[model samples]
Target: MSVSVDSPFVHKVWNDSELSKMVDGGVQFPMLSDQGGKIGTLYGIYDEEGGVETRGRFIIDPDGIVQGFEVLTPPVGRNVDESVRQVKAFQLVRESEGSEATPSGWQPGKKTLKPGPDLVGNVWKEWSVKDNYDK
Candidate 1:
């Protein structure tokens, strides 16, 4: 889902003119409008002076808790792939009941760290960066 200060009509126009070309059916999720920056302000992305929300991607869990978030200036675009990866990581951790932790660049089926007191300060012996890229 996306939220911006742009009105719904602007979203429609932009989707029809720009987003459609990049995505097969435009965006698959909601593109909500936040004309007065109400929602954006809550997320701390609203630029009151600019009257626009900064580019941001937030991964909110089912409990309404923000599991992960990234905010960037308008000049830079967010990374969808990275966002997806983080979401997957968050899901995995949740499914495991916080028993597991994803290493950097972790992907599905990759080895995950078993977080515990014994593993503290010994992570280097258990996992390595190579694990992220290995088949």
Candidate 2:
């Protein structure tokens, strides 16, 4: 889902634009219009003077708790692939019963860390990389 301070009419216009058409089979996600910036302010992304939210992405759990979030300046673009990966990571951690934690630059099929007091301050001994992360 993407939320903006624009009105629904503006949202509709953008959704129908040529750039938006480049989305695979058209946009599959939700685009919410926050008419008065209330939702953006709630998410702490609304710029009062600018009256627009900087690019912000939030991963929320089923219970409506925010699990992970990223905020980017307006000039920067958000990475949809990274956001998808984060959602998967959150789901993985949620199902792991707190026994495992994803390492930095973790990807699917990569090893995960078992967090514990003994693992603290010695994580480098457990995590290793064959090469730099491609992402």
Candidate that scores best on TM-score: 1
Candidate 2 lDDT at 67 equals 92
Per-residue accuracy of model 1 over 1-135 as CA lDDT, tens digit each: 889888999999999999999989897888899999999999888999999999978889999998878889999987788888899999999999999999876888788899889998998897786776656
Clashes of each: 0, 0
Superposed by TM-score, candidate 2 places the C-alpha of residue 22 at a distance from the truth, in angstroms, of 0.4
Global Cα RMSD, each model: 1.8, 2.2
- Pull out the clashing pairs in model 2: none
Each model's lDDT comes to 0.89, 0.81
Measured against the true structure, the TM-scores of the candidates, in listed sequence, are 0.90, 0.85
- Write candidate 2's Cα lDDT for 1-135 as tens digits: 778877767777777875377775556677788877899898898888988888878889988999988888899898878888888878888889778888888876777889889998998787766532754
> Which parts of model 2 have CA positions greater than 4 angstroms off?
117-122, 131-135
